[model samples]
Target: MDASSATAGRTGRATDAASRRRPLIDLADRRALLACRPDDAEVTEAGRRLKEAALLDFGIKESVVAAWLYAKCHYQIPTTAVETAAVVAGGDGTCLLLYNPGFFTEIGLGGVRFVLFHEARHLIHRHLYAEPELRADPVFTLAAEVAINHVATQRLGQGLPTREVPDGRGGVTTERVGIDPREIHRSYRADLREQGLEPLGYDDFVLTDLTIYGELRRMRNPPVPPPQLCVHLAPDGEGPALDDETVGRVVEDALTETMRAALRSGGLARDEMLGLADRSESGGERLGRMWGRLGLAALRGETQKTRRVEWWKRWLSDTLASKLREGERLVYPKKQGAVLLALGHEPMLSRRGPERTKVVVVALDTSGSMPDRVVDWLTTLVGRTDGVESHWLSFDGAVMPFVPGERVAGGGGTNFGHVVDYVEGRLEVDGKRFEETADAVIMVTDGYAPAVTPQRPDRWIWLITDGGDDWPERHDPPMACHRVTTGDS
Candidate 1:
């Protein structure tokens, strides 16, 4: 064999040996990992102090969200392989924080907060289900590191931890943590000096995930760090091995709290949340839909342009909230008189309103083009809502109270007038009374038929399907109308 062939065989054998030598974690190693685990009480106590300090001082929403996310993360032992820390899917609708106790000791509380906050931000970005194309590229992995670290540095007003980091020479060296973007930028500038390549500002470089990815790709040779740079992205940076349902719950909770924090506290907190909402991806379209459900329009300051969610859904949520905000009124005369008698000052009594069942009429045009996915989503949404009684109607030219899992025949042209008539108590179907006043009426249709005015125009919601004529938009007196997407658009 040639010299090169002989060397290749030796290297292959070495690689195999190394792979075999690395111990796979099991219950036996669990004890060792636990032993190296950071003092739980100390970490917990530090977090408590941080949260309390935040509350006592000028607390921001981002800080509040950071605290909340750290609480959600389940701490675990960083396996012998992990260099410092990582956020992995806990496999139970949350992320896990696996940290090396020695590493934690090196960075101190400031670094712990930085790492914990960094992990939390990963959840917000939904990094687990990151783009496949990006995840496969080492440049993209570097981009994520740059973006996340920049945010942590800027928001926390702290620098990267100057501690023991891997030197890629099989030895640890005391230096700042991992590969940094600014350092890479400096190198890029030197390489392209007098070439008129303007380095983007630090803030602009990490503007969004795609922004950093795009800018870095322009480099003659982007700085791709060694495999051990980031534990989460190490070993080729593949996504977590978690199901969609499990990841969905975790993302939902984080996004929901983020939205709340934006509402309760504005300024930096609001901006951070706004950035998250704006940066969310839209293939399955859950992020945008969640923002719509949150009624993000309620948030003040900067506006997030455009939404991937069906227009009708946003209109429905907003209109429903308005209609149900004031529920059934209950008079308390005894309490009113007692208050007046107790105090020398006269009191004017007012009845309290307890939220009552919101009677909702959902009319589905199960015609030639009705999307089953849309129907299923609508049914599920309505069913899950608290204090909501739904009346399902399936119509083509004629209207019928359709039960789920039951087939309904539809062939002729569309007629939205029937829905209006039924809601107004002007028509009866199958001897059932239309006397029950509905709090809201939602009509999901192809909009191929003539439009009719509803008795209560304010409570009527129209969801025109794809390729359907949005007559409501051009209608003289516009009603609550929007278009529904079947996830195809």
Candidate 2:
């Protein structure tokens, strides 16, 4: 041989030797792999080479490669004796032979090569790493089919022919490719055979179906409905009547199983999954037991007992309690009366509004930065009070007064000083008819604005939120500001 030919021959032999020394059934040197004696030395040699090449090409480690091969040889291959053969003459040229001896013609290495290439595509796609079978198998097959066809077209100059077949009549025809879809499917099986890999028939089909169905279904079906969100109330009455937090939790739980399954199938990574946990302890029960912590259920006694007390106190007291004797009726009214009655005292009205009328003003940021949770909670709280006169105002560049029963939704840029100025301009010794100027001014925001001292000397409460571009300066505090971090606050 010439010098170049000698060097190429050495490289080929080295490659083959590397391929052969590697074990097919990795089984972690486990007992299962140790027990599978080769049918002969040639069987052992073939098994080793195939496993090595498969592991190297698929990018799976040898240990994993062995586990699968051991299972195939000891458990599956014996029952199906005919195996794929190959003839390698160096220069990356290897002929794949596929035959079962009894039912099918002995297919040339071209068919085998095509199938292996297709399966090789799946390995690169890394679909098998999921556990609990979260990933569909057909996804792999479909990916392989498309990839192999491309490869066949590129390397062999063999474009899959789109022939027009006669369709029951002389005049009409149907367009079909010369290659069968099943034959394309058979490629992956052949690829696995050449590599000493054999999964259970059911498992193979499952994976194949997952890939194929994903593609074909994509072609046939309309886009899947955006993941449905069914809102459920949290158990402790802390969250809104219907909330996203509850839905988010359910989605997290659903994906947890999928995450675990993906880890087992072989090539999947964990971080690709998103939103599997709460951003904050915002929704669900106060005690966090709703949905049994996975975000789903209700407590029977807790819900019913609380409802029963509220029912008689708020709804039934006037009709039912009037006829009863003083000590007989369970009439709980007013703030003190509510606390006392719950402590088993006779019902009374101590919790009722003070002898003087009370006025409360809510200065809400209609800024685009306010989260949906903040707006919903504020709306709920403002709606719940019965006796107090309430003023709701939202501002950005200017303060827009929102009277009770008027709908004021959140959305706009924030300018806190302007809002403060408006509050100042509107307030005087004699203002719009009211029993008292707002005793308390509650401001809800993500703290995104220029800091300003409020004109009114009322007590101020701030609802601070997550993620905004700006923050109020601590040196410029509003009147007696109290901070609340989440919706429950």
Candidate 3:
């Protein structure tokens, strides 16, 4: 039997291991088939070629990020399900790359690489900018396509994909190129001119995806239409269900693996990975947190001045709030008091009761490891929180009460057990006991000391410095632990 027929016969049926190992069919004819429903033979041929192109073309040096992303995706299914291609969250908590075989064949190898890279980018972009409001804007949708295509063209060195179309005469002509950011900018300029409004220059127009969307919004009438070919962007597009949670998990895992590989290789791939992290820093909270975990600032050679409100700070603040708000209740004035207040006699007040003051213990390991900047930031956050009593302790082998900006001399072995004893009211500092139970205990350390479980483990949050052992995470019952980028590492 022919290769195509043999492959077709096994399509809707399960196959043994031996059958699966057979070689894929090679297309005898490479011409684009125009039939609405191509024969099984043609479909099988197209699928085989498409698979070959992705495995061979995308795995080259030129396409580092794309190659890594494609490798991370567990499944690549070929069918007539999608018009071109799409990356969607699969039911089994993985990402699936769905493509139409005919569409892949029509665009050829260069186009296949372009489309694959484009789809991979779409997955990353979706994971980074997951804000619902951002996705809802039509301008933002167009801006994403422009930004993605722009980067793809630059990296792939393939300007754009062109498809062959039937001319009025018998011969075929090449037409229908991919989305061009420059062309869209020109349209915006023309629209602005017609409306007697000033348009941004090409450089400003294509700075970033958000910048593009913001500039497009200023136009009286947006010149560029929404992307029609993007299946994920279309509200009614058909395919497997795209789960946000699954997408986030898969993308995060893929990026983590890619970043590790780049770090080990340390070449063009590493540089490209760093660039990706820098560009995505402004995307959203999830992306920012992931980058922080990956030590983006350290890789980029950034210093203290370049640091902004990092993800760890936000996470710490939120965690403190949650811990402090526990068991708190709102107290309202009685009905009679409410009536009198309504009549302008007095104003009724509703306040959080049982709120003497929330106690927070912030212990910094001053064994010459903790960053001063982190200590300063933590002080500001804890000091500014209302109705909270703060205690600052600097500990190496022993604990000492010290205010922010007060330098405590240190050079000794680290002992987390001492800090725990003080916070749990077992040990005294300066001949005074910690009378109140701490609502939250934040420990900033290099994680060099032995792991010790606190009395109130739920209230403890550990911030381990870069290259430090995060032993708290592997304790009997893991505590909330996060790595803080020190920039030096």
Candidate 4:
């Protein structure tokens, strides 16, 4: 019997692991078949060689390993009677069978390889297990599908036979027997949706990979100072032709927007021109009009275009100067010591007995790698308040009590989970849930820690990092973040 038929009756996990040990066909039979020109006896051999070459060229030789493992690990049944399909499995563990010989022929060997790789990629990403987030993860799904398809196209073209199959034979004889790329793309999206992944639109085909590569690069060598502003410039604009002058304006504009919204308002107004200082923020169109007036005013100052109408340069310099001044102040009111007095005056807290006052556990990640500014702000936030008792735990790899008002322990390896476990224990002992037990748990670190999950937090704030570590698939807590600058220390 042929190798495909030899294991036809097998099914389930019992044989799954064992099947991974050998080639798709017995060795002797494979060699004899590959040693010949395309013929009836060599059709399966041709298919095997095409699959092998496809796997090697595509950088997914493990796909074959995966296929063997999957086959050995699950049930397999003969589908020779079916005419136009290969394999289909939904994330829910339900699977479909097809007897389409065109699966091998019509799409060509490369296409089959890509199909397998595409499905395996989904499994590796654990998309099948996370239905709710499948749509959200279309980036991974679509990029993976493209990669698989590229591989399949390359391999099947070079390896699979182009000869016609005899009419009575069990092969697809039609010229256009392969799955349509459009249909395949649609099916790919549908599968992603069924598994809870948001299907990425065609636009995301380019966008998703761009974001992924960017993120991966960042993860390897984390960004230095936290990002002060995130600006997504439209790519279509011929805006100033991207010279140094244009780049400067873009950066300046981005900073101006960030500072105007995030930083406290106090700066030199454009010109001595008295304009209405409305309490309500104006639209960008109004702002643009104002900007134009300011530029015309500057131009009116000096007729020379170089001096009077350097709109971008003047706008950048002034905006940057203002933001630089505001950057000296922490963006959050609570972190600046202003919230303590307000909290003390709140009616509910004031009316409650002193005995019911909440406890605040502020754990600081005093790792060797943590920046000094983090320790200072951490100490300040935890120490600034009264009306409620606060405990400080300073940890590197394990927890220990630290002096309430001092910056004593820090500069060691950080373990974020230790803080979580410590807080969870404290909440348990206090007979209170996280929300009630403490007003907040403020963690200060660079976010260089193993995966950690805390008990439900009424308020948990991350003060150390702009970014890092998104993993373990789930169990992520909703986090409030404050980007800290390294210069603040």
Give the better candidate number (2 or 3) by TM-score.
3
Q: What's model 2's TM-score?
A: 0.26
RMSD list, candidates in order: 20.0, 24.0, 13.1, 22.6
Angstrom error of the Cα, residue 182, model 2: value is 72
**What ranking of all candidate models by TM-score puts the best one first?**
3, 1, 4, 2
Q: Provide the lDDT at 375 for model 3.
A: 74
lDDT of 3: 0.65
Candidates 1 and 3, the one with greater TM-score: 3
The stretch of ten residues in a row with the least summed lDDT in candidate 1 is: 1-10
Query: lDDT of each structure?
Result: 0.58, 0.35, 0.65, 0.37
lDDT winner among the candidates? 3
Q: Please give each candidate's TM-score.
A: 0.50, 0.26, 0.54, 0.28
Candidate 3 ranges with C-alpha deviation above 4 Å = 1-43, 224-228, 236-240, 284-286, 303-489
Index of the highest-TM-score prediction: 3
In candidate 3, position 249 carries an lDDT of 77
**lDDT of predicted model 1:** 0.58
**Greater-lDDT candidate between 1 and 4:** 1
Model 2's alpha-carbon lDDT is 0.35
Ranking by lDDT: 3, 1, 4, 2
